[model samples]
Target: MGQHEFSEGVEVSHSQYGRGCILDMIASQTGGIDDARVLFYLSGEEVTVPTYSLAPASEVTSVESTRGTLGTTVTIDDGFYTITVEPDGEGTGYNLSLQAGNAILDQAELSSDKLF
Candidate 1:
């Protein structure tokens, strides 16, 4: 892909890292695309990678959500990332989680109103 500028919070994909969200970006001191880099969060870890090696997260061309007896599961994968919402064991609320492959980046319990 051609060199392009990216800002914080943008989701990007790398050939080696899969999908990640940009946490910060450092401009090249020499104003060279080869030197510019970005700090991104991937699989629960923060990593810095060269901008040239990344591209805007491959478009999420297909998304699927299924509701079953167990819970609701949503898959939005450009070959990465799955989000899940399930009833809290207590039956009081729903638990939401964001996952990339096997890494759970965030999980939270939400009340009915918050979930809907």
Candidate 2:
């Protein structure tokens, strides 16, 4: 995925998943999104999408869109992997990452169209 321009507090709308909020971003130590990923909270679940399939959310009304939640750094451990969720600003957007040491597992992002 290329460089994506988005704030830390903005709602993202997907063409398939409807409306969701950007939870967080995982960039390289150099702040590069080469293997970066984002966590999105949509449909009552946290989904990981690639940064390439991202776009800003439009100001349109839709039934699938639900008001996203905002919060501070939330961490969850499933024994094997440790997960963290940090929301952006007081609105939505934040950063979500999954990695083991210096290796990146995956990266996700938000957008204004379908992800499938």
Candidate 3:
């Protein structure tokens, strides 16, 4: 997949899974190796899945209308990633959020970005 495939505001579906909305896409160094990561909400749970395992957004046919929002920005030793909340703008703070595993290696903020 190209870098543009990880763009914000994209919807996708997985094989054997119902559907999921793309929250944040980031690249980071893991154990001296670079890896692409994609964070998304699945079945009301926050899941951080590898970008390589994700199918193209167009191939997903069971996509839902639910959208995601950028909640916060997090930075670690190797790289940085963002926190995302589902269902768009809903409250003053994020009740649920997800971040890349590599991005949570250090202290970071939750809900750094405002919901639009």
Which has the greatest lDDT? Answer: 1
Q: Candidate 2, residues 45-76: lDDT per residue as tens digits?
A: 66666555555555332122123456456554
TM-score of 2: 0.36
After TM-score superposition, the amount by which residue 75's alpha carbon in candidate 3 deviates from its true location, in angstroms, is 45
Weakest lDDT window of 10 consecutive positions for candidate 3: 73-82
User: For residues 34-102, what per-residue lDDT tens digits would candidate 1 score against the true structure?
Assistant: 422344445566777877777787554357787866566565656466777776656566778878779
Ranking by lDDT: 1, 2, 3
Taken over the whole model, the C-alpha lDDT of each candidate is: 0.67, 0.49, 0.44
lDDT string for model 3 (22-112, tens) is 6665556554212333334445544566665566655633222343354442222111123433422443444334344334323322343
Q: How far is candidate 2 from the true structure (C-alpha RMSD, Å)?
A: 19.2
lDDT pick, better of 1 and 3: 1
Candidate 3 accuracy as TM-score: 0.38
TM-score of each: 0.46, 0.36, 0.38
Q: What C-alpha RMSD separates each model from the true structure?
A: 6.2, 19.2, 15.2
**Clashing residue pairs for model 3:** 72-112
